[model samples]
Target: MKLLRVGPPGAERPVVLDGTRYLDISGVVSDIGEEFWRTDGVERVQAALAAGTLPEVDVTGLRIGPPIARPGVVLCIGMNYATHAAETGAEPPEHPVMFYKAPNTVVGPNDDVLLPRGSAKADWEVELAVVIGRRARYLESPADALSYIGGYCISNDVSERAFQLETSGGQWSKGKSCETFNPLGPWLVTADEIPDPQALGLRSSVNGEARQDSSTADMVFSVAHLIWQLSQVTVLEPGDVVNTGTPEGVAVSGRFPYLRPGDVMELQIEGLSTQRQRLQSAEQEA
Candidate 1:
């Protein structure tokens, strides 16, 4: 099942995609959030739809917001793709390299991305974002990790290289946590719908020029393994957002120029959905 949130930025209401139409599910759940994930919200919405009780919404000209609302943790795995690591002049890690982007960086799919003040090296990373369905702690094996996931969505893991590498004192979050840096979702496709997350094709482009074009098949660590490994160190909570990492061909490799105001980025993952964001300058400090 595909789920989404619609309306203005902070006032989006929950809805489910049905046969090219969006059905209002707000009456069934407050929002597609922690409460929804905690209470078997997907099943409840499915039952509501099956019973013909939900109303169809006219989504024309409305804004599409992030699929999951107010995620507690925005965890990210760095260099999960081998080629990406090589492009950035690093050896493929022996284990998952993790970092955290503030949850407030999350924004709607088509929202305008702001280039932070004094920024000169903002880049785009298209990644498959995993949404946690339930709490997971110390999972016995990688085979058991899939059950902890709620759904999947597309994430544009936008970053600023200057802050990330030159200024970060070895930390990556400052470069990644800029406002509207993470553009997520046209919709969230439930886990059951995506039988194999590693098989999907994900790519990105700037100003209609192809940039990163690769498949999840190139990932150094599979989704299940990342979940299993993360569970060993941290508790994966419901509604948490995990960006699995981007593939090769980003501007960070120096093959292309960094993002500038007026540049546009388009990201897509087969079977999930597409996202487009135009770059604009954030107000400069006085």
Candidate 2:
């Protein structure tokens, strides 16, 4: 099932798409909060839809927000794709490279991406994001890690090369935490819908020109391994999002030019969904 949130920004209600129509699940599960997905809410909604108990909602009248509310953490993996690493002139690390992005940076699909002040080399990276369904710690194995996931979504990991690399201070968080850098969702596709997460084809384009285009098959670290590794140190709570990492074709990979004001970005992954974001001027952000 394709689950989503629809309405104004802060007032979005839970909804499920069934073919061409939408069923209102807000009456049963309110917003896409932590409790909603953690407490078997997906199963409940599936039962309701099967029993014809949910009310039909006209999705055409409302705006769509990110499928889930503010997650507790927005974890990210860097250079998980070999081709992407090669393009950047970096060797693939033996272990997963981790980072964090504040939840405040989360925004809806089709929202305007802001070009932060003094950001000249802002770039785009399309990645597949995982949403955790259950609390986990010290996961025993890769298989155990897969059991903790709720579903998946499309995420644009917008970056600023100058802040991420040229700056002397810290990790990539500076270039990554800019507001509106993470545009997630058109829908949160349940895990059952995705037979093989590793087999999905992912792609991204800037202003109709293709930028990042590759398959999850190229990921240096698999999804299950990432979850297992992360759970060893930090607790993975319900609704915590993990951006698995981007594939080849990012601007910083040197295959293409970087993003600028007025450029639009569109990204998609099989079974997850697609998203479009328009780049706006820094003056507009001010």
TM-score winner among the candidates?
Answer: 1
User: All models: lDDT?
Assistant: 0.95, 0.89
Q: Least lDDT summed over 10 consecutive residues: which range in candidate 2?
A: 30-39
How far is each candidate from the true structure, as Cα RMSD in Å?
Answer: 1.2, 1.1
Q: Sum up the clashes in candidate 2.
A: 0
Q: How close is candidate 2 to the true structure, as a TM-score?
A: 0.97
List model 1 lDDT by residue over 59-89, tens digit each. Answer: 9999999998989999999999999999999
Candidate 2: lDDT over CA atoms?
0.89
Could you tell me the TM-score of candidate 1? 0.98
Candidate 2 per-residue lDDT over residues 1-286, each given as its tens digit: 8999988878888999999888899878867769987788988998999899888987776778999999999999998999889989999989999999879888998889998888888999889999998998999999988888898999988898998889827789999999989999989988888767899999999889887778999999999999999999899999999999998888886668888888889998988778999899768877
